[model samples]
Target: MPKARAITIHRHFIEPGTDWNTEDFNFSDVLSAQGSSGDALSITPNFRAGAAPENAVGGGNLVDIFNAAAEWWERAILDDFDLTLNFGWAPLGGGTLAVHSLVAQEGTPNRETEGTIRFDNDGSSLWFLDPTPDQNEEYQTFTETTTTQLGGGDINIGRVYTDPVGDAIGRFDLLSLAKHEIGHALGLSRANRSFRAENMDFDIDVQAPRPFPGTEIPTRNGAHLTLNTSLMFPFFVTGERKLQSGIDILANAEISEFNNINLNPVHVPEPTSTPLILSLAMGVGTFVKRKSLKRQSGL
Candidate 1:
């Protein structure tokens, strides 16, 4: 997870015009891997700014933004656990459907193989569909597969990580987007319309969807605005980085299982040059019970 013994970044899936082949680029440079001072979730984006968007505000250095996003997650949730993320890079050629496309492969004890695991495919690969007002890019759907035991928890076989946020038009925060996707890869899914039950988003099993308690957050201009606290919320505004309590509870429970894993993960080099390999062991990623998506009332 920390180091990609061997990694590469291929072209992304495209529509209408030209789709980048999945074997276009290979990344050896580790842009940022800071779970907390040591080896944590990483971003290997050393390639030129070609992958970055034109309207990019950070001097077009997507690498910095991406790392910060990863770092935020590290601090917010998975920081305690010595986790390593071998990121697969796909420098933005143009505006794409999704910014990040990940495949979370879960493997349990008896059935360590990914295919063997039961997937609650809602028929759609989108874990979290955003409020992308622009409506242009078409990364469309995302899926998951394969499995090999990684320590204790499931290794998120992040097939391909892309960015949905456009450089200039995208007011989305880097950490916000990364955290949202990472949530799914780490067993979190879009809290359906029926997310909140008894004021609990997951309630051990995902329930009806309910907008998390909105906090009065201040804008840069000193104006205050209310933003939903649920990180798993479906609709995405420009800058939303609130970590809900329930998600924390779930992720914490998941992390406890990893306590059995060695502080440092053993790097298993892959045959393919470009691929993020993550496998969840039995107690965790198995028996994925998709919470019924019964619409509830909320914003």
Candidate 2:
């Protein structure tokens, strides 16, 4: 690794979709608190017979769940960068990972497809679209949302980005998606690979060879797409999520060049508690289904 100047990468978490409390207070106290529905409160894991459960059972917020996701990944990838990365559900200068409301972008009626962030031509800036700011607007950052989880479906499919591992039920897991997209935003792209950057080696792992039925793995060169996979494997499998061993190294290398930093910098979120250091069964989504991310779309 070559040495360069250190740079600070600003990380913004945008929530165009549902959000937790704009600011944190008490979660448990909100149940039976009040409402237009006037329904009684019960935070059981099962779905109740009304809009209340779908909208406000337990009053759990995806925003806090996402915050925790950022926290886990940030802690996991802090080895090589002199990072001052900040993660928040606000509009800061740094690149953003946004989630928008369905009505905002006139995007697609399909709930299954959420594109990644849109970047500028210079590759110097990017922001998310959705949670429309106005009828004719592109986006409204962090719109007040009330979308909550209904847990206990195909928990492993990675639909909801908030479900935790070993939990009785599941929702979409956001760790892998957040980490992967952030990786792209920071400097993981086909362009960098084509540019002959060392990190793009895509090396194959021959040392830690695995038995059949094992998750794909990558070495320093490239991966045997069929044999093993990593976090950046180009496709996310249902219930799948885990950072590859070598992906972080490439991140460090790329950021070193992009920021002219002594190291490549990336940010996850700082954990408010002990995190589960386990791999998720990565998911397959519109973005992951594509053979590769667009030349520079970053989506």
Candidate 3:
């Protein structure tokens, strides 16, 4: 059997539908080099109910997003290893042989009480989106999230971008947001540093252990750290296009790997070689056939 070569992305938030534009992520770019160099990888899409929010237990009847995400990975990329993604609820359960877990953190009770930061009206405020429930707002406070295993299970998607009122204010795109967090959950640095060239100085430590101690993953990509290019870039995007260049980069990484396997550039035989080989073999057969026919005819 052929070696497994592919990363499968499972969408846990199917009900709300994903804001992700698969074309934008360029899921084939990352696999380009792999295909060209012979390290082929492909992408499989898994659509399931991976949302396992405690709130979803009621008649809400929402599927266990977290458990579903884990199962998606096990079924999709566990054997493939390129990478599998989940966007919804929290990720529980540990890793399996056939899947690598990728999920986003959803709830944050601690963040709501401590007050969070936000950038609006051309200014940055520390106490603007507080813990009080207002008229237009539903929730408040921002939590410090980390990309760690939940109960020794898979790593939950970390919410580095703090916007308590985003959904209520019609600002946050959950699918887009989850995609960004998923990137970090995979391997993109979890630092607070925004990928933008300007705010590159605001670094958040992503190294160390669970609590996100002191050492942060440097914004600068060195031998140890790699850069992620998804609009889900560590910070936030509030522009008209609302499309970050990083999203393309992240998508490209996946795309590149996928294209490699499907394209099959290396193993494909050249045009000229095919006809030549076939013609030589056919010529011998034709000659033998003519001779046999002549003998049988008694010429």
lDDT of each: 0.27, 0.25, 0.24
Compare the candidates by lDDT and give the number of the best one: 1
**Residue-by-residue lDDT tens digits, candidate 3, 102-145:** 23221211000010100111111111221221121222211111
TM-score of 2: 0.31
Off by over 4 Å in 3: 1-5, 10-82, 90-170, 190-230, 237-241, 244-299
Question: Which structure among the candidates has the greatest TM-score?
Answer: 1
Report per-prediction Cα RMSD to one decimal: 19.5, 20.7, 23.7
Question: What is the Cα-based TM-score of model 3?
Answer: 0.26
How many clashes (backbone atoms < 3 Å, residues ≥3 apart in a chain or on different chains) does model 1 have?
36
**Cα-based lDDT at residue 223, candidate 2:** 17
Q: TM-scores for all candidates?
A: 0.35, 0.31, 0.26
lDDT of 1 by residue, 211-268 (tens): 1122111111011111123344444444222323233323322322222211112122
Count: clashes, candidate 2: 33
Task: Flag regions of model 1 displaced more than 4 Å.
Answer: 1-50, 76-100, 103-106, 109-170, 189-203, 206-227, 239-299
Residue 295 Cα positional deviation in candidate 1, in Å, after optimal superposition: 41
Candidate 2 or 1, higher TM-score: 1
